[model samples]
Target: MSALLVRHEANRLGRDIAVGDIHGHFTRLRAALDRARFDPAVDRLFSVGDLVDRGPESEQVLDWLALPWFHAVRGNHEDIAIRYAKGNPVDQTSYIANGGAWFVTQPLARRPVYAEAFARLPLAREIETPAGPVGIVHADSPVRDWSRLVWSLRLWRAARDRAMWSRDRLQGENADGVAGLRALVVGHTPVEDPVVLGNVHHIDTGGWMQDGRFTLLDLATLQAIPPMG
Candidate 1:
């Protein structure tokens, strides 16, 4: 399948922390990690994607991706970079307008490298936690049942697209939560504070914006670590 689904075993040694969309703010991410006292020797960090774009450190995405403790899903911004690098149809104006100017300025030889790395990221991840299975997607969950997510995403293009781009759950008044997963965390749409709609938790606190603070959430407890003072 073009789109991929990955499962991670429970972190028996330490914490499994989930962070919101990075949007190229590696410096802010590092500072937040320090505040959380994250230890790569034991703690693992998971990203909701958008690792590049918007911020000045867009070029440092690869370095962060190479870290063994970092795991991420594919964000829509990454999709734009991938399509452009692969010679697929993309709107250059839209891409540049949405904090992708840095990517367009990258060397021709290096452009494909970003695409290659991002392309490797799975569209959906099911991480086993002490509490239960936590699903991570860039946007919204395509299926109401998490158990069928893997096959649905693999077999249906619509399901894969919704996984990375849909926002229906947030915009609508649906009070129902996805079944099977203890919690589903997403990061594409930014909010002033983390919002929980049923079992889905929206944690994109606009870390890439001038006034926003990155949120570090404890996956097992479903609680956000307070921002550094």
Candidate 2:
């Protein structure tokens, strides 16, 4: 692994909030931030990725990268987009079929730059705060032992891909816990509300749904900040 695979110390600031998959809909992001009275100067926003695709404003999702307070791990959708941008036709087809048709509409020249940026996104984030250390991953945190997972990441092993695409962890009757994590925060599994299984919490509420609101899980408070009306 290299620096890309190891756990780097997190930069803690005022208030740190973890957001579910945005899936584009940049306006909703704004609304959620506004509704929570998010102060960018004094607050921090962490994303679970899927920042683009399937919404009206997919193209604008990249703009969030410019914000100093915004941080994220790569979502599975972002993985596919990175592949497609890197000239992988298989991923292009898969991405388009999975509500990412707009990806093909973007100007070809800009995709390389976008793909480079998206590919550089971390696969996991561990933040140590006054509340304790919170871990964030896009989809699932495959291993129960966080150290084993970190080792796998450093070795560039098979478990790396599983972290971004696996849903089996959320399906079983067993309430498996990720060992050594205070709370493992995940997206990609949309629920009517936040679902807590052992130490794992799923916050992706399918905000694109008609009744959904972009959820911002406040780490300082460990509560979902209300979304816009």
Candidate 3:
């Protein structure tokens, strides 16, 4: 797959929902979808990634990936797993410290399968919505110009890494937002609630944590759907 994937005129017949970092919490995700009345037969779900690690059911990542209605971008945790699977230099200790124990403890033979599957995910995704084109990246965009980043991702390793790992936008609290796009949704930094800095939306509610709430943002409305009890 290309470093960036663009889907134009999507979800014409149904709603498009974008969710925060799942971090292996499938049960919570399912509940949230249920609350939102998500219908896989029509409604499509988009994830900002970090689909594995930090929560129970980490081993079920592959099954989730197989869902036709589910799409995801590559996140930092996935990046670490890919590097380890390729026998490339990776900080094993740090990876384990950051909720990667599930992956580390998996059978060695399974690493490649996970890596290959995750490698097919794009670092960033652009989906066309009625409001405009919305961008989804694991972390932050490389530059303020969303169009430029999309055009350069394949040849720009720096941009790809930034898309998966950078938190500058959140840290600096830059509200200028990206151009050439309606909104950019991301999920590396966990916020108490969905926070919108200009058009960049941070929706990772730390769903992997015991006290965290899994949030599902309506892509068409750019609003958080209140999870049903």
Candidate 4:
């Protein structure tokens, strides 16, 4: 498998935290980061994607992503937004119905900018840290042809095609429930609670839903910050 070895210099004494879907709730996101003692100047922040849509502050979230310390993978929402920006035929009705109205309400100038940003997000990223390797993506794969699956442009095209599914369906069979060298980290289907099934972990806690909470996972210790409130 071809993977980029993403290396970052360790801070004097800082933790590398990977967070799940933000979904535009900047307030709660900020609070969670603060509670986790995340120092943007030193500690690194990686997001599993879905940084926009379904909540207030979508613009603010995009602005925050432009920061150097923050890295992210492209989520399905981002895929739809890019298609919309390019004037491609998208499920506008479904998108708007599902909090996509926020993007439409954005200033025209900002729309293109955020769309470009979303388009630039990586499909998958390999974080090579002192501890181990972590692979970040919006979802996992269950196709037993794992090697072929990762190399297939078709799989990525399908994911970017804006197909909608329930949380369970989205989880598929590889829903962070297996163990391997490449630990999978993802945030697509929001969960009532973060799940740790093997070497993979699902951190999307649905901060946009009622009684929802944002979560950050420390890569080095493999610990979930805030202890699941």
Candidate 5:
């Protein structure tokens, strides 16, 4: 992955817009946004994570996600990078089998940029909306009681730990989804179609697999914008 220069501050908005796992499909992402009439100049876009790896254009995806108009949480692939960055013993076999080698093979000059970008991404985002609060993460969050979990430190820490370890138990309908929050948006388990599980939305539609289409979910309306391709 290449280094993405953060030219501006993070986007903080009361409005709603959320995107699913990009996985390096820049052309498709642009086309989807165009179809949806997304205006980065005004509206905000949130990513579910896994912005890189297992794709032909990881560098471009990194650069695109780094744009000021978008925000993303850390995914399992990112956790692998963090471990690699820290010289921690990673599961080399699984990491490479899962496409970590591509990222490791990138030019050294670009590694720092990716590392910095990864370091800056928040584990979870709290969006204050008229309806209520929306929580965004790469996978399932630890908020057992969605209503009480809004902006809670305990929930954040649990979600952060699950993200970092790539724990499978944290992927699906672990604890019956969010209770009180308006919605919990996440991307990790690639689905043939984007799924709305209770208050949770699974937006990773396997762009790396069969027709190579990525789905972007509109947070406010819960609409799935299929890949433009």
Candidate 6:
């Protein structure tokens, strides 16, 4: 087992922004960033993962994996994508049923590269911000203990099951914050509005839904943009 935690060096620009489940909505994400006057040189985007699937630009978002300013956690969608790419018939069925039709339509030769990218994504990230250390996990952090969570992340199976898929942590959020971090940001579950349960925040506004839009949070000010039309 290897450590799955990635430590993002503290950003002093007070311009770190977090965006909820992208789900392949790159254009919308860019619009949100433009509206927010995002400066990639200083500001960093901590994506709550799900960078692909469920939208027209799913494949396009994969092209951004190499950009330095973007950071992401392993979301359940990514987990599904990876499993399906590895020749898991059951996972293939699940992925295709869950908005992965476009993925299945792609050439099989291109699938391995995508799988390699997903495999490299960190399951969780802890960043030192102007406020304090902010933790980012795709869905929920099943373990309340930071040390234990790190331990669990080292094992690929545990990280995939708990960090990427579990929603149990939502029930534990409160003003006290989870794992003693200043804040915990998550996105597997969608919410109409960004809501904070204790110190845990769910920012996924369902960008893939017909009536929904992506939510981008300016962590420095704790303010998020209203969903677009």
Number of the candidate with higher TM-score, 2 or 4: 2
Q: Candidate 5 — which residues are off by over 4 angstroms?
A: 1-15, 146-159, 164-175, 225-229
Candidate 2, 1-229: lDDT as tens digits: 2133324244455678898888877788887798888999978888888888888887786678878788888888888888788777655566677778887777999887777778878888887666567888888886788867777766664576777877777777347778887788888878888888888888988876678767788876678877546
Pull out the clashing pairs in model 5: 147-180
Shift in Å, residue 212, candidate 1 = 0.7
Q: Write the per-residue lDDT of candidate 3 for residues 7-56, one digit (tens) a residue.
A: 64667899889999999899988988998899999998999999998888
Q: What is the lDDT of residue 56 in candidate 3?
A: 81
Q: Local distance difference test, per candidate?
A: 0.90, 0.78, 0.88, 0.69, 0.67, 0.79
lDDT of 5 by residue, 184-221 (tens): 87778777777776777777777656574667666666
In terms of lDDT, the poorest run of 10 residues in model 2 is 1-10
| Model 2 collision count | 1
Pairs clashing in candidate 2? 1-154
Give the per-residue lDDT digits (tens) of candidate 1, residues 84-156.
9988988889888899999999889999999999999999888999888999999998888988888798788
Off by over 4 Å in 4: 1-13, 142-150, 153-156, 159-180, 227-229
- List, in order, the clash count of every candidate structure: 0, 1, 0, 0, 1, 4
Candidate with best lDDT: 1
Model 2, global lDDT: 0.78
> TM-score for every candidate vs. truth?
0.96, 0.90, 0.95, 0.81, 0.79, 0.90
User: Model 3 segments beyond 4 Å from truth?
Assistant: 1-3
Per-model RMSD to reference:
1.4, 2.4, 1.4, 4.0, 5.1, 2.6
Q: What is the alpha-carbon lDDT for the whole of candidate 5?
A: 0.67
- Report the error of model 4 at residue 103, Å: 1.3
Candidate 6 lDDT at 133 equals: 79
How much is 178 displaced in model 2, in angstroms?
1.0
Model 1 residue runs over 4 Å out of place are 1-3, 227-229
Ranking by lDDT: 1, 3, 6, 2, 4, 5
